[model samples]
Target: MSDIKVISTENAPAAIGPYVQGKIVNGLLFASGQIPLVPATGAMVEGGIAEQARQALSNVKALVEAAGSDLSKVIKTTCFLKDINDFAAFNAVYAEFFNAPAPARSCVGGIDLPKGALCEIEVIAAV
Candidate 1:
């Protein structure tokens, strides 16, 4: 088995559970799902779905970067929304974070997210 390195950073919200923020193994980084909690305050960002989506994506970016990778290096992502109806708004916000040839993505709705966040995002990237 390859050596695994745990990834964490103060620039991103601390993990609220037992899991670390992410892990790197064999040149790949796998980030945990990031909710809309503000890293500095540990408080859920307040606003609508778009605002919440932005914060969640921001948190994902921070964690990815902490693992020595950037958003452009992300290969895949999984997003969850409390309400599927907010998909369009969430997509618009998400588009701001990634460029052309964006990472393969899967967004699902009607799901319960941690800390009552409107959205959550996790990423896989090349380290």
Candidate 2:
């Protein structure tokens, strides 16, 4: 564990569970899944998947950058949706954050996300 370092930031919601926001090890940052809670108030963001995805990804960006990495350095991502039918809408919002050669991804739906959030996102990046 000597090579591991914890990462955190005030820009993202605090971890309400027994986990840190992220950890860097061997040049990689593993960020915990972020629900659509605003860091300032911890209130779940209101709206549908598109709105939720943006907030969740915003949290992810904060976590990733806390470890000195950016979205462009993300190598992979995993997204969870409360409803699978929201895939198209989720993708639309997601494309706004990631671009060409975007990180490898796996998205799933019907996830009973915490705080009843509409979306959640976790990432792995080169730190």
Candidate 3:
């Protein structure tokens, strides 16, 4: 059987739906898509794309760390954006969290996100 473990952390926003924060299997951490909801308040953050992106990435970072990994160890990321025009702005914020040798990524636009968030981010990392 596959050895899969669920990853959870109070530092990040709890899952809004019926899902865990992340999963670890075979030394890899697969994190769920994180929106800009404040962990403590469970409220969507208010701001432009940059601010929202920062919060989303921060949530991702928290979950990654909770899984015994860090942003530097991320292998891939899938991002969802409500508006394509915010790509540049989102990238600017995303760059702040991920350093050089950044993980492979895919960002899609025009997707309706939960809680009307500007963006959401999910990642995979080495644990």
Clashing pairs in 2: none
lDDT by residue (tens digit), candidate 1, 48-110: 999898888989998988888899999999999999999899999999999999999998899
Instruction: For candidate 2, write residues 1-127 as lDDT tens digits.
Output: 5588999899999999999999999999999999999999999888888888999999999998889989999999999888999999999999999998989999989879888888889999998
Cα error, residue 107 of model 2, in Å, equals 0.9
The segments of candidate 1 whose C-alpha lies over 4 angstroms from its true place after superposition are none
Cα RMSD (angstroms) for every candidate in the order listed: 0.7, 0.9, 0.6
lDDT value, residue 78 of candidate 2: 94
lDDT at residue 96 of model 2 (Cα atoms):
95
TM-score of each prediction: 0.98, 0.97, 0.98
Task: For model 3, give the 10-residue run with minimal summed lDDT.
Answer: 43-52
lDDT of 1 at 124: 92
**Candidate 2 residue spans exceeding 4 A from truth:** none
lDDT of each candidate versus the true structure: 0.92, 0.92, 0.94
Which pairs clash inside model 3? none
